[model samples]
Target: MYSLKKELLKKHYKGDNKSVEYIFNRLTDYCGKPVRYNMSEEEPDYKWDFYNSLFFVITVVSTIGYGNLAPTTSFTRIFMIFYALIGIPINGIIMVTLGEYFGKSF
Candidate 1:
């Protein structure tokens, strides 16, 4: 088990041997462990369903965080970075528009 882990660390890891552990831990901290996510298979599409996607977007835009619904893939993670950057301002505009609409109505 240990050898396999070490072998994987060596195979995928690009850093110098002395800093492999440090790089692994640092990268894992933000990116999370893909192996663990793969092991615990939940829904076939975690955010594909309408409500699930809505919930995910709400959390991301509101800066409430994903909680347990973390992005596992590198592409999804990178996409989410852009998603949040754009979504937050869009959401803010929607909220302000609604507030003005309701205020005028009252």
Candidate 2:
């Protein structure tokens, strides 16, 4: 029972700020003490849902060039211009590094 409580406590504290707050709340019920921690939600400037971001990053690095959904604004377009200049060579280097690592591992 103690192990289970400890595990639950550990699990609760393992995520970001909101998660720590939740864990602290649950801990209060167990410990019979009023815990206080003011936690604020972290809202990302450009929120990329995990799965979508994964797909987008994979597509970018893999050089698949799927043009279905792309940048659609002046600012984003301009950013992409700079990104293309710096990113392409960096991405190529990363791909080469990964390939070498894979080759060695295999």
Candidate 3:
């Protein structure tokens, strides 16, 4: 049981880390920035600013679907479809495994 739990945690962190890296890379590639950080730059505000984009990614992987912010461009939208396809399940598994571990401990 301990070994199984350890494996689950290992897989979860690995996948989650990859997902986060992908989100950050995508945001940077798309020039997303936080709302507050926008003042420092002379560029137009994007729909998926850094903070909002991070929130968006978290909401997506966690299946929250807040519907507040979203990808505007077709490319980004398409990319998100694929991203979610892979990320959501990994995150769900992680949450469930962690919950089970804690529940068992308690």
TM-score of each: 0.53, 0.43, 0.52
Per-residue C-alpha lDDT of model 3 across residues 5-91, encoded as one tens digit per residue: 344445554556665455445445555533221213344556656887788889999888987667779998999999999999999
lDDT of 1 at 47: 47
lDDT of 1 by residue, 4-94 (tens): 4466566777767556665455546746643331223354556467888788889999999847677889999999999999999999999
* Candidate models: Cα lDDT each: 0.72, 0.66, 0.68
Clashing pairs in model 3? 33-50
Question: Which regions of candidate 3 fall more than 4 Å away from where they truly are?
Answer: 1-49
Better of 1 and 2 by lDDT: 1
Q: Which RMSD values do the candidates have, in order?
A: 10.8, 13.5, 20.9
lDDT of 3 at 11: 53
Tens-digit lDDT string for candidate 2 (16-101): 87776777677678777554453333322455689766666566555675754466699987886676667677889998999999
1 against 3, candidate with superior lDDT: 1
lDDT of candidate model 3 versus the reference = 0.68
Q: How many residue pairs clash in each candidate?
A: 0, 0, 1
Runs of candidate 1 exceeding 4 Å displacement = 1-47
Q: Model 2: which ten-residue window has the lowest total lDDT?
A: 36-45
lDDT leader:
1
